[model samples]
Target chain A: MYEFDYRRPNTLDEALEALRTAPDGKLLAGGQTLLPTLKQRLANPSDLIDLAHIQDLKGISVEGDTLVIGAMTRHAEVATSPDVRARIPALAELAGDIGDRQVRNRGTIGGSIANNDPAADYPAACLGLNATITTDRREIGADDFFTDLFETALVEDEVVVAVRFPVPVRAAYMKFKNPASRYAIVGVFVAQNSDGVRVAVTGAGASGVFRVPEMEAALAADFATGAIEGIAVPQDDLNSDIHASAEYRAHLVGVMARRAVAACG
Target chain B: MTVTVSMTVNGEVVSGEVEPRTLLVQFLRDQLRLTGTHIGCDTSQCGACVVHVDGVSVKSCTMLAVQAENAAITTIEGLADGERLHPMQEAFRENHGLQCGYCTPGMVMSAIDLVRDRPDITEDEIRKGIDGNLCRCTGYHNIVKSIKAGAQAMKG
Candidate 1:
């Protein structure tokens, strides 16, 4: 790993100040992805502003019909939180199945969505449940948050404070995971609410997490597994790798969406 | 630049000056001479460096030594009580849960954390709980048995 200065700030203002002072600085959340990236020399930052010490950034609460999860709240906390389970059990299950137990203990919701890995699970939930990402500067809707693979709408100095997820009437996420990494080869999150039905696809998208309008329209009409069985995402826009072909991922999307719809029932 | 990091390890408060890039596993083995924590794969994929930080299991190799500042850590060395083996360790010995022994330390550490609160943990849960720790030897059959036995023994 490259040499760097480490600063643990007690408050958001101090962290922001540190980021400004160090020109090339990275905010260290759970460090699940950042630490590994550093070890491989993929990134070089002059300073690392650790966010673990900021007390206000760790919690889970429900406000109105939305669930507010603090940026630093770990995946394990989300998986086991009574509030999260009671309000959004599917979201809790998604959090529990990410990586593994140890990974869940350290990986946080803010970090997961901020990194926005194409194969990550949180983006699907964010998009499917209609989440609002509250940053140090402003609130960004989920549809506008994920821009590309490993990218987000966050500015250089901006910090993600919390994610506000509107509780859906019912939602379920199903993923065909890579055996080794446990990352989704093709994951689908299907949600039905009073607004309508939203079908979000992750891991298979070439751009990143995306919504399938055709599948959403089909599910909205019937709200059944068989209703969307024929609706398929095009292979041209899906990701293909050694683990699965674009055609296979396209096929899995239909399978997973159907399974997710069945799970929602 | 070097930073002074202090943390409670094995019930003893220890401090060391290390580079900001130094991993927690490196700090434990090189500076503190706690060699019991093995590094099977320097990458976080292998659970050979699993340790408890603030009563939760985490990959030590993925964490910076400085990140654990003022935290409570329990390594493989901290499990046994002076010549007497921990229940998990004893269960492993009884169940023949090891062959090459490279992955034993991590498996034991992860197993203890897995069964912390749950008394009647099922075999399927034990298999899933140790997903992070891989055992090339023993086929995980004995490891699963050992964790089940250990979970029962821990109830006492």
Candidate 2:
């Protein structure tokens, strides 16, 4: 790893100030991705502002019909929180199934959504459940949060504060995981909210997590495994990797979506 | 180039001075000489470097030593009471859960944590419990069995 200055700020204000003062400073939230990137020389930040000491960035609470999870809340916490499990069991199950115990324990939801890996599971949940990402600067809706692969609507120096997930009537997540990394090769999150039925697909997209409108429309009419029948997502915009081809991913998307719908039921 | 860090490691208070860029894994292994915590993968994929930070298991490889300042940590070395093996360790040994033993410490740490938090853990839950820790040798069958046995033992 390249040499860099490190600062552990106990308060979000101090952390934000450090980020504002230091050029090319990266905020270290759960470090599951950032540290590895730094070690591999993929990222070369001049300074690292560690967010672990910031108390405000951790915790989970229910606010009315929304589950408010702090940005720094670990996946393990979310996965095991009784409040989360009772209110949004799908979200809890999704968190529990993310990347194994270590990753769930170390990786934060904000970091996962901010990194916006196409194979990541959280983005699909965020998009499918119509969650709102509250950042240090502004709040971004799920539709506008993820910009592309490993990119988000967050500008430089903008830090994610918390994520607000509106409790859905019923929801479930299903994924075909890559054998090695355990990342989703193709994952689907199905949810029925006040807005209506939403179907989000991740890991299969070329860009990043996205909603499948056709599947959503079908499921909105009649949410069932059969509802997704004959609905084919275009393979042209899907991702193709050694684990799966674009067509295979498209097929997996439908299969996982149906399974998720069944699970939701 | 040096920073002062103070944290609770294995229920004991520890203080040290370290380089700004020193990883938490390095601190646990090199600085503190707590070598039971292994570093299998340079990336965060392998759970071989897992440890509890404030009762939550995290990948030590991804964190800077300075980041854990004033935090509470528990490693594989802290799992047992001196001479006795932790129930998870015993279960792993009995179930043939490990092959090369490289990932054993991490697997044990993660399993102990999983069992501690969820007493009613099932086979699928055990499989998902240590999903982050990779065992190229065991194919995870025995690992899952070990976790199940360990959970039962711990509960008893």
Best by DockQ: 1
Where does candidate 2 stray beyond 4 Å?
A: B94-99, B117-120, B138-145
| Tens digit per residue, CA lDDT, model 1, B1-156 | 899999999999999999999999999999999988889975688798999999999999889999999999999999999999999999999999999999999899999999987879999999889999988989999999999999999999
Worst 10 residues of 2 chain A by lDDT: A97-106
- lDDT, candidate 1, at A46: 96
- The weakest ten consecutive residues by lDDT in model 1 chain B span B37-46
Candidate with top TM-score is 1
Docking class of 1: high
TM-score of chain A of 1: 0.99
Error of 1 at A134 (Å): 0.2
**Candidate 2: tens digits of C-alpha lDDT, residues B1-156:** 888999999999998999887889999999899999999988788889889988877889878888788899999989888889888999999999999999999888888878895667988778766777888899999999888888888987
Which number leads on lDDT? 1
Compared with the true structure, all predictions reach lDDT values of 0.94, 0.89
Error of 2 at B42 (Å): 1.4
Query: Stretches of candidate 1 above 4 Å error?
Result: none
